[model samples]
Target: MHKIPSSEITPEHLFLSRRQLMGSAGALSVAALLAACGVRTPGAPATDTVPADARTDELGDPLNSFEEITTYNNYYEFTTDKQGVARLATGFQTSPWEVQVGGLVGNPRTFALEDLLAFEQEERIYRLRCVEAWSMVIPWVGFPLRRLLDVVEPRAGAQYVRFETVFRPEEMPGQRDRYYPWPYVEGLRLDEAMHDLTLLATGLYGRELTPQNGAPVRLVVPWKYGFKSIKSIVKIDLVDTMPTSLWMALAPNEYGFYANVNPAVAHPRWSQATERRIGERGRRETLMFNGYADEVASLYAGMDLRVNY
Candidate 1:
């Protein structure tokens, strides 16, 4: 894997300025003011225990503000409008959460929210490339998903991991829409789920996740598109056959099971060659695997990304 030079990293002072801007300016004014001032936002500080490599990605991009990340989201469980999710999910319940991990696991068990948090936590600064052709640099606080899976001990023949989100039509109005499926679902190959980069994010910016952000717990697969990282997880099943994801079920032609980020393969409606980074002025060239090709490219050595994507 390529290592980013220290000189390329954004300065700490710029991060402070960005944080200040987030607190003072409106969401619409943030990008303009920051660009004019030549300043950037900062992410939550990581503890000394966090590995140096986990503090930032190879891109050395400045972190997006808490306001932007929390306010702008793609959580369809709450709403389709990106900005409306935060407001709609405000009253949604996340407390007293428990995730059932069974299926092909030999030691299947239900992990409570507290139990999940009990695992050793680390900070990972990852770039979130959404399928919609937008991106964000997020400092996520969580442990590797492999750590949780290890305890359950996936049995032989467990080829894939299936994830299910909470189903509550009363709180999440979007769930009531019969046009789409309720209880969003996602899946990952066993190796992908076990990868070190795969995180079960509990929070961002050093604080507990809010309801809008998949609170309590969520999956963060940095190499793939943002939607692959399912939120508000309630069930996990290790199965032999590939599971059909919600988006795949909704639009099989547009959304595939392996939702990996591939700039070469454009979305049917739009080109994926470039992306508008949140909190930035203009678009930048999109990188294969969201700039994680060095780390995860080998996982698809014999496969075709265009076909799998």
Candidate 2:
């Protein structure tokens, strides 16, 4: 996801230029903001609050808040329709859930979802962007993906890791009898899988995850397109080479492996050069890491991003 390059993103580039465009250059569109499932309104009292953890930002404020953690999600398995997941996920069986780890790892093990909850769950308020173009500021609850991998211990041959959701047509009606692939598959490079930015969240808010939000357990790849962050994860495998992801398999060039939040590289069908933010706050200019670049960009130093992308 190498962006078009800063020189190409100046004020004159009309496609997504900062010029006097049809809409305000630095704010969210009213309609676009409304369509987002996670957008929140200001003055909204905390109906569901997670007390702030001790881990605070430079300002000494808690890193995450309950309202920001659970209220926002983009899980599509429960339903393609935005409001559907949050509603349907209530019936999800979280207590019986288990995460399966296998493939190119040394400590391949199957642990109950409860086992994952034993760690120190901290909050990280991250700027999340959906491939569809809408975005949000969410505080997530979970530990680094490497923490999970460390226990299972990926083997040397684990060049790529693949994730899949549990496919129960009875519960997950999206398992089309045809038309769509059942048990969607998503993958990540060894490096990306182990990145500190990746999270394996067992719960959001102070409660368990909602079905629509990959309830039992889910992968949170904040920088990659939402699809790369699969929901209701059931199987995790390590492969010797590149693994094809659902979006990539469906349309390769549209989603490159290095799906970094780059503003320069435009999607063939859409313009990611800019994004529409939601919540009563309105839209704002999208930053390099959704504003986390200064913290995560060094991971891609010498590589030819355009090619890997």
Which candidate's TM-score is highest? 1
Q: What digit string (tens of lDDT, one per residue) describes model 1 on residues 122-239?
A: 8888999999989989889999999999999999999999999999899889999888877899999999999999999998878787788898799999989999999999999999
Write one digit per residue (lDDT tens) for candidate 2, span 1-309: 876977765454566643546567335676566565454444355545555565543423344344444445555555676645555566766668778889878878897877888867876555567877766555667888888888888777778888888887777666754455667888888888888888987666546666666777788888766677788888988888887776677678778766777666667787677776644344545556556676667878887766766
TM-score of 2: 0.76
What TM-score goes with each of the models?
Answer: 0.82, 0.76
lDDT on C-alpha atoms for all candidate structures: 0.88, 0.70
Worst 10 residues of 2 by lDDT: 56-65
- Distance from true position, residue 244, model 2, in Å? 0.8
**RMSD in Å for all candidates:** 15.2, 13.0
Could you tell me which residue pairs clash in candidate 2? Answer: 3-264, 3-265, 4-264, 4-265, 28-283, 40-279, 50-66, 89-211, 105-155
Q: Candidate 2 overall Cα lDDT vs. reference?
A: 0.70
